[model samples]
Target: DPPNAHIEVSDDGQGIADQRVDGRYGLAIMAERAERIRGRLEIRPRHPHGTTVAVVLGPAGRRDSV
Candidate 1:
């Protein structure tokens, strides 16, 4: 991974009504996945429409030789 990796997933549909409380299983799953990989998940509304899901991740961990 690079110094800072930004994974942005956006759609041109209806955006998230509220950022704090979302009762969607998909969103929950995404959050879990991000956390599991030591990343940050952010869900926000687009400038015009739809939703924007951004996942910010740090560089990958170093692996030691066996």
Candidate 2:
């Protein structure tokens, strides 16, 4: 089996929208950093409220492994 690593953060405040996120440079920077490390960055609204931010990577030291 391969090594898997992920970091997740959740908030209880109002969720963010795509339109609102467009003006936020921090999110873009985070997404770019994740891509450079072969990781996936996800930002989505949580159930009913709040938001979730996650960075998931597969296979340690394996950048090509998605």
Candidate 3:
């Protein structure tokens, strides 16, 4: 839909350590941008490996899948 969008970034490396995200400049910028577009930001660890970052937009961020 034109009023909705998403963006996801993931990695297979060692993944983000706990404190690394707090003072990080790049991640902060990304989160800010998401908020500006009225989107939600999610940062979580992957199943067996790294980290996943997801941004969802639209009403309640509900979607079938992408």
Best-fitting candidate, scored by lDDT: 2
TM-score of 3: 0.69
Question: Model 2, 1-66: lDDT tens per residue?
Answer: 453887899999988865755466988888888888877799989888999999888775355543
Which 10 consecutive positions of candidate 3 have the poorest summed lDDT?
A: 57-66
Kindly indicate the candidate among 1 and 2 with the higher lDDT: 2
Clashing pairs in 3: none
Write one digit per residue (lDDT tens) for candidate 3, span 1-66: 544676788999888878865555987887877777677688999979999998878665544442
For residues 1-66, could you state the per-residue lDDT of candidate 1 as single tens digits? 463667898999977766457465888888877777777789888878998898877777222221
Superposed Cα RMSD, model 1:
5.2
The all-Cα superposition gives candidate 3 an RMSD in Å to the true structure of 6.1
Query: Candidate 3: lDDT of 58?
Result: 69
Instruction: Return the clash pairs for model 1, or none.
Output: none
Off by over 4 Å in 2: 1-3, 20-23, 60-66
Query: If both were scored by TM-score, which would come out higher, candidate 2 or candidate 3?
Result: 2
